[model samples]
Target: MFRVTRLAVPVLALIMAADPAVAQDPPLCAASSDTARTAAEVIAAVAEHQCPPGSRLRAAMTVAGQAVVLQRSGICAPESVRTMTIRPTPDTRALDTRALGFTCILATR
Candidate 1:
């Protein structure tokens, strides 16, 4: 029984170490405000910094707690999707990005 238990422990350790999911690193991320003046620019900067060549944009959104304004004439209008403007709220003003309020995720193709 003692010898079996000793062998089982090593076998279990080897099985767990062979898992691809356990060996993989978490996704990379980057944020920049100094060079990224617009949403497009911010996404580009983050991709350049964190993603490898041939990567594509996966998701983009404003940072939490940042105030923003969405303007549109009417819901049914063809041009109703107007613009999204980021404004500095008291809580977000002190953030490292100064409330530019842009973040992006990228994935390898």
Candidate 2:
């Protein structure tokens, strides 16, 4: 009886330890004042910084205290969507591209 009681206690704890509530809330990525700007706005902003076209821009943002990271969308010549991850940094602002493992280039096309 003593041995059975000890084992039962541990088994009960293991079963009760699992909580289903944690699965309800998942990490999310929402638009913020910074990301609130449109793709063209971000691209144009980066162009002012001399970023060349056909480049990639990665932005790490936080939403609801959760980090929502994404690459900027790119626009090709003739104004068509060629890429989904494209971010442009403004020329006037000194955004560090190295931290994102990518560099910001001007978009003339």
lDDT for residue 28 in candidate 1, whole number 0-100? 37
> TM-score for model 2?
0.23
RMSD of 2: 15.2
Model 1: residues with Cα > 4 Å off, grouped in runs:
1-4, 18-27, 32-39, 53-60, 63-90, 93-105
Over 23-103, each residue of candidate 1 has an lDDT whose tens digit, in order, gives 754343444342325444444565467655222222223432221221111111222222234555666567734323332
TM-scores, one per candidate: 0.33, 0.23
> What ranges in model 2 sit over 4 Å off?
1-34, 59-74, 77-108
lDDT, candidate 1, residue 77?
22
Root-mean-square deviation of every model: 10.6, 15.2
The numbered model that scores best in TM-score is 1
- State the lDDT of candidate 2 residue by residue for 38-95, as single tens digits: 3444445555555445444433332211211123243223332222223445851465
